[model samples]
Target: MGIKSWLSKPLASWIVQKQKKWSSDPVGTQKNVFDLLIKKAQKTTFGKDHAFDSIQSHADYCRLVPVREYEGFKEYIELVKQGTQDVLWPGIPLYFAKTSGTTSGVKYIPITKDSIGYHINGAKDALLNYVHQTGKSEFLDKKLIFLSGSPIMEKKNGIYIGRLSGIVNHHVPGYLRGNQLPSFETNCVDDWESKLEKIVDETIDQDMSLISGIPPWVQMYFDRIEERTHKKIKDVFPSFSLLVYGGVNFSPYKRKLIESIGKEIDTVETYPASEGFIAFQDIPGQAGLLLLLNSGIFYEFIPVEEYGSANPTRLTIGEVKTDVNYALVMSTNAGLFAYSIGDTVKFVSTAPYRIVVTGRVKHFISAFGEHVIGEEVEQAMKNALLKHPEVSITEFTVAPQVTPEEGLPYHEWLIEFISMPADMDQFAHDLDQEMIQKNIYYKDLIVGNILRPLVITSISAGGFINGMKKMGKLGGQNKAPRLSNDRSFATIILTA
Candidate 1:
């Protein structure tokens, strides 16, 4: 039997059992996972300092281990860099996932054997759930391509360092290597354009069935494939049926992807951070991603408004109510104790605990008291697209035009359009209107004339690409910032 056929039944069975348990007792499963996480790390230095042994309840875990960000954990991370064993977890991490940072230079996230298991299981369950929902396992017979970073790792203080995708690529099991694509050497190409060219050249003729990556990069691949093949992606690869994406809002890229594919296909969204794999689209036609409760990560939710307060109330899985935006805090097997990864989410369902990503804690524009978040911007854009079907935004960023040289203070938008709207003024007006409806603070600012109407700046083709290249973050999971408090990124695009 083929590898997929051999593994299909057992994998499906395991996922069925997991889903049964998950739906039945999410809270109990969460508690068990939390206890397992603490027990596994109890002998470590972080555990000792945090009093993990005495942590018997969620409240105890919260009280003992305060919510921390990367800055707060930097000292311990430095210790790990200096070859300290068991500084955070029971042993040294196998690798450090180097995250691209806009504020900080680079963040080295610990990737232990236990943590890697979480990543692998998350991917497995994502596909297994897809198969369970659709009853379509035929795609498994063809190649599964991940537009990922180079698997070649760099050594930093005796630990391997690379992007999370690249690190995960190295761990792709031997059994599935035959179905994975883009030669390892091609992935190692540092330049974005060069990498794209190589990937297109390598996979243009292959029997690709599944493609997974961040939307923008995957779109780039699709564009390149079309450019080379002179046909739609579906025509080029008849078996191509699955597209898995995350790391950015899919709403903006949805039209572009669908247009490129030339037909509808199965699409899955995932929330995989360097810190941990948090959630994935499980049930077909579900609105939100089902939270991974039994993963080796204990989750806490703090209300976004109270995020920076001296003592914000942190809620557990069972405590969170639907539709409340909360910043996610996680204590994981990788030895991060109550670490806040800065992404915000809102629970949409309580029965099985599903959530939608709202925005980032830091990624917002409120320079003139007009607080606007990633979700608001995305929704507004979606609303604009609905009104003007001709236009589609490929990528965009918004910044406050605080010190206007030519006009009053306003929000500045730098947009890379797949197709321009018929009426630019109306399009911009509709977007602003949607934002006003969604955010009361923004509406107040506009109504009071504290902020001028938002000004839309059309970015020329490849503007985002050029800007990201200038920022030294051209590829490999690096995406353009959607919103910024300042015009640093927008200025670069405007100047370029």
Candidate 2:
């Protein structure tokens, strides 16, 4: 038997057993996880400061710890950077995962030895979950490719720092190394173009069966592969049976991805962040992801409307209701407590809980109090595409033009289209009308002459990628923000 087959049977059994336990008593399991975390770190500085030993219930924990963004944890993190042990967790962090977050420009998220277990085990269980649900194990016998960040890390004080994906690559299990593609040397290449070319050259002839990456870059890689071989991706890898992705809504890029594949393949969505692995698609044909309840992270939800207020109500997993948009707050083994991760989600199921990412907390344009969110803008674009049936957007970002000298203030969309529409004016009008229909505040602003109709700027070829490159955020796991409060990205795109 192959290594995967030998491993899959026991793993699948474990996953099935865990799922039954979780579904049977989700509330009891959640409370046990919370209690274990608090007990584990009661002697640490963060816990002691917050009276963790004295805390007796969920209410006590909530009342003692205020929800905070990374800025609030900056001081504690600085101490970690200087090699302080047992500050946040039991010891200094194993490493810090760096990323470009919305509020904090360059965020350094801690990854403790304990916390890394969650990521590693979560990934293993996710794959096993797929096997348990689908009864498909042939893909496990072939090579799989993950287009990920460079694993090259730089030392900060005594801690290593790099992208989270890169850090995880260094920890791939020994048994599964043969199933993974792209040599370590190529993966460490700094430039994306050079790395992608090397990867295409390395894995083009392998018995590749699965691929995973963020959607936009995956499309770029597939296009490059097809260009070189003069064949579609499926032709190159006949065994390619699954595509795994996350980090952005896949709906906008779905048609293009399917066209590139040229064949039917199962798609699995995962919800992983630098902070922790949250959820993954477990069942075939399921609409939402199964929340990783047993992972080493404690979750809290704050109603979207209550966010940015002085004191938002923080609800535990037991208290969360289905279909309500709530900003995600997490406390993890990495020593982050009651921390806001800046993304929003809506629960689709309460028992054996599942959720779908709704939008981002910081990605919105509310200059004129329209309070437009990423989901609203994306849905509006989707509606416009449905109506026009001729245009396709590769990428887009919206920002406010508050002080345009030639026209009234408006929301400007800088877009890169795969196929341009015949009449740009009508296309823009359709998007504006769709937006008004979706958001009452946007409609009121337009009616009051407080804001002009939305403006569309057709970006030149490679404009968005070039802008991302210039901003030093051009590769794996780093996605361009869908909306920005200021015109920084808009100005860059216009001038690029």
The models' CA-based lDDT, in order, is 0.87, 0.88
lDDT of 2 by residue, 276-359 (tens): 999988886788888888788889999998998887899988899997889999989888999999999999987679999988
Q: Write down the TM-score for model 1.
A: 0.97
lDDT of candidate model 2 versus the reference: 0.88
Candidate 2: residue pairs that collide? none
Q: Estimate each model's TM-score.
A: 0.97, 0.96
lDDT of 1: 0.87
Q: Which lDDT tens digits does candidate 1 get at residues 1-496?
A: 4668457757877886877787678788878888898898888888888898998987787688889889888999999988899999977888899987666678999988888988987887888888877777878878888988778788877789888999888878776788888888898887888999998888888999999999999988999998888899999999899999889988899998999999998889999999989999987667899899888888899999999888899998889999999999998888898898989999999888999999999999989766689999988988889999999877999999888887569988889987898999999899899988999999998898888788899999989988888888777788888899998999888776
Candidate 2 TM-score over all chains jointly: 0.96
